[model samples]
Target: MQMTKRSLPRATPEQVGIVAKQVIAFLDDVRKHESELHSFMLLRHGQVAAEGWWAPYTPELPHMLFSLSKSFTSTAIGMAVHEGIITLDDTVVSFFPDDLPGDVSEHLAAMQIRHLLMMGTGHDQDTMDALIAAEDGNWVRAFLELPVPHEPGTHFLYNTGATYMLSAILQKVSGRTLIDYLTPRLFEPLCIENPTWDICPRGINTGGFGLNVTTEDIAKFGQLYLQKGLWNGVRIIDEEWVNEATSKQISNGDGGDSDWAQGYGYQFWRCRHEIYRGDGAFGQFCIVMPEQDAVIAITAGTGDMQVILNSVWDHLLPGFLPDPVVTDESSVALSEYLAKLQLEVPQLRSESMLEAQVSGKRYEIEQDQMEQAPFPLKDFCIEFDTDSARLTLKLECEDSIILGREHWLSESTITIEGKDTRIAGSFTWKSEAELVLTLQAIETPFRVTLEVHFIDDAVTIHSRYNVGWDKVNTVHGRAVD
Candidate 1:
């Protein structure tokens, strides 16, 4: 079954009982804090109230939803339980006898599928790193061998490996991958097309992360939950499952008025204001507000996720009234503002005298120096042109990326996180001797900025990510030929 159109019906903010000016305030707050949001969508009463995507980040492209993927993993598990293929009381070891450790402890043996869904697997720390580093690349074995000190359902750790185990269990019982399992029941019903989920070395979907879908897809998922698992008057999942999946299942100890403190459900974080959300690292959110009859979906590359929610509560929350208010003036202002939304491009300060001298120079970086780079770049060369510049980076082979002198240029084959996605870049002269190249991964909340300083016959390159573990990496190179 194919969906007629992959979008919900559109309605003015006032038509959906939302004040346009308040939405403007929410957007203004985002800009004031310089939050790098790629897209935003607001849905009220099953209609789209507002939607926008920053330039170069189109609505059609899929954005990576790190742990937000866990929510979908949870949905699949709930479906499996509903079909009687699996049960919440099923022991984790029961599904994987072949992968069990030599000596399963009492705590490990006691772990249940429910514990994995609520992230109460009795693990002391996140098992993600250890699973990825397993020598034999057997993540299931690695996870099973880990020590479970606390009794199942007693400890509350945000364990991602536990979610992966849920995926493994579903696959074992259903004989299908997570994506395949959800296709007929979820994606097709919602008209979410061509979504991608990265897999482990063993071909299991990385259940806790690596799912990519459009902003609309996220909003639809939230709406499905808001409607108690009903889509177009058809029951996609049991209403009982939706209630159990979204209700607080455990205390996360993240106390305070903070959203994280509200508690945790099945792969969903309960937020302040009686809301529950599925969120990913770097600000991918599927926020469902049942009381207000609304859903807010967002994708961003911001360091502070709390501030974004604060914007929603402080500005947008009060505007959701029970009846429509006069919003003609504010609605026009918002329309004008949303149409003009675009990410600022780097501007060239001035013409550089050194540009001609280094136009076609190749720089050879040593292995020790290259180690500092985020990408395994062996060498690099820059070729200047009248209107654009070509950056040649040697990875497995030479990859050329173009940067428009005045605007952002796009290259579709740039590999990021083992996936080929489009990248938009622009170059600017920081100074006569310094040049900066900014590359944005169009489908993700990530950008890499390279600052190259030319001095004598050597060049120093500093690479930085807008949001990541390491802030900066530096490498030195000598001019070659």
Candidate 2:
């Protein structure tokens, strides 16, 4: 089912307003907070309470879920456990005996299914990527053959490979693919129709990541976990297992204080707000706040995922509650804000003023910096459309892209439909020559608004997405007149 609106049951108006205001305020700050860095999709209490689509992104589109797929894999395991097919204590070696390494150490032999769930696999030297890339006939078998550098319970590593091994183990014990096993038990029950997950060359689901889905589907998964695996009065997953899986099982030394300090659970991260989330590369997130009885689902594309987490912990957590008493003032504000949220293609404003700026003029984009060095592509180009308000760009060794026009002087907007994505943004020439661009991706929960500073022959671009500006991907482009 699509992201259909679900009615609020027994709630005062004020509580709703708080959520609305926060969301609106959050969206309005796309540039100050570096919205360009990610693709964010946020859902509130089963309604499109507040939504925005940024440039370089759009709604009605799909995004890569990266490692977030592991959470779903873990959920499948929970279902299987309740059915008596396998127990968390089951041994990894039990699945494929012949695949074991030549010398199985005491530590490796002692590894249990729970170890995989906790990512405390006790294999220090081996990584999930390396394990999967092994030339062995079977990826799981390759993982099984790796040496156990330490005891399972003694260490914790962020291993997507361990998650893959879990999916393989489930298939072995249940005689069914993860998608097949979870279809009726999870997807159907939750009404997440036709969801897709990637498969390896070996025909196994890429357990760690590679899940692609709509933002609404992610919300449903969050709702399931928030409700403790119960859907519309049907108990699909055991309540006990839900509790155990979400609770902290291991301390991921890698994550720092506050939200990060809480620890890690079975394929989940324990955040500071007493909440648990399934997060993926960039910023794909399924955040469930049990105390708030609320779920916020987000699909993102960013370099540093923690900024997204920090925003949730710092901005969204404190305001949530299991059942909020509504207030009229808050509800009115929320309704107004909801009514205010709109995504439309703006009218084009002829670049008459820019005509003088452009006529036979040479331009250049200076001070291009990247948070992390962008590999493969060392240069880029930016060309402008005077009438349509468009910018055609080409990356030296990357993808081709186009930004469509903002139809009118009053309409300050840009629609970016690229080789791989559809993103739109609003633009305003706040100054005589400087242009302010606002981008909101309908596919994500975040926004990126950039201020383009014009110079004699150069433009300086800078933006932030509610976090530190240390990680910036800036580039300089010279107009080849």
Candidate 3:
């Protein structure tokens, strides 16, 4: 019973409406928060229950999954365990003999695979070793060398380094990379494709974070976990493993609040109503409600993960169980709201769709190459693509220079020198007339706008890269022709 594209169930128009009204309200309130909450998508059962994207975002774009990646890593470990390739009781030191510290204490010595899975790894700061020791490339050994203060089961510390060690152990016993190991058994079954995972210096997928995937794909994963790893009729993750991984094994959050909110199990977070979720740093979440038979996936650029959850609980939770399955007034409003969700992709608005020639599109770019020491080719021409209107500059052959391997362990930047400077990636255009690109380069995301104005003989392109104030770039094509 493999799920085909056609076989997936669509939410009934009634169900769709209920979900839509809530989404619209949630999004409206979040915008006022004035946060960097970039994108969001929601799923129920196995279908795209609801979806929406705001300015400077779209559904096709890929976003960083951050530490929500640990769930994926843990899933890989589960697969290996099912195949009998590794046992949870296997010691950490057993996987990487070359990196174990000489004076490892009895508690550290007693640490087993399950401890890492549960985030009970004894380290003062999870990333201290990797950052201070410069072990970004060789994270596994760097993590294993850290001090383990607590007895394996005595305490719980949210340590990502522990998860990285688990990834290493899986590679050690299974002899296959994380992506390769899960591709056939898990990824393909879910119909998720072309996922990009950033590799560490040692070439292992960063088990804690750095997995990039679509919002929809993560939703499918939540649904898979919700169904107890049963896709269609086939069980990919053993039922026992799914239960153990999601069951509360430790309490998290220093608030020391109720056990329901603070509990964690095998790389998953426990929420209200026995719900557990896979959550990432900047608001990527896959909340699987097994009892309710619902899964909610979200990908956002905001810093507030809890607020997102609070919103979910406040809005969507109520719709989960409608006692008599009411069928009229409330349902119609929800449907109408969902049907109104539009991408708002503006048309080119320019009179004709013809390629408007590039000869008149050349502009002298007085480029500013940041403060990191100007290397080469600071001067260039800005060339516009006449047919597509995508701004690109053809770099002279001599301008093509090489820079050595860049490290992301710290602030890493790459400077490309070209005779014709290209408009920044964020200084983008979807259509000729409607040009707005938002770049998340630093602390706050900045949007660059190019408003096409018809002045006498030409179409002048004015841009506001910093202030809303405009600076004319150049004019192109005949006024009428």
TM-score versus the correct structure, for each prediction = 0.97, 0.70, 0.71
Quantify all predictions' global Cα lDDT against the true fold.
Answer: 0.89, 0.63, 0.60
Query: Taking the tens digit of each residue's C-alpha lDDT, what string does model 1 give over 271-312?
Result: 888899999999999999999999999999999999999999
Expressed as tens digits, the lDDT of each residue in 268-293 for candidate 3 is 98888778899887677888877667
- Write candidate 2's Cα lDDT for 177-260 as tens digits: 788888999887776666677676677887888677766677778877877777777887889988988999998765556565
Model 2 bad stretches (over 4 Å)? 1-19, 25-31, 35-52, 55-59, 254-256, 321-481
Error of 3 at 450 (Å): 13
- Candidate 3: the clashing residue pairs are 17-334, 17-335, 137-201, 380-419
Q: Which predicted model would earn the best TM-score? A: 1
lDDT (0-100) at residue 470 of candidate 2?
43
Any idea what lDDT model 2 has? 0.63
- Comparison by lDDT, 2 against 3, better one: 2
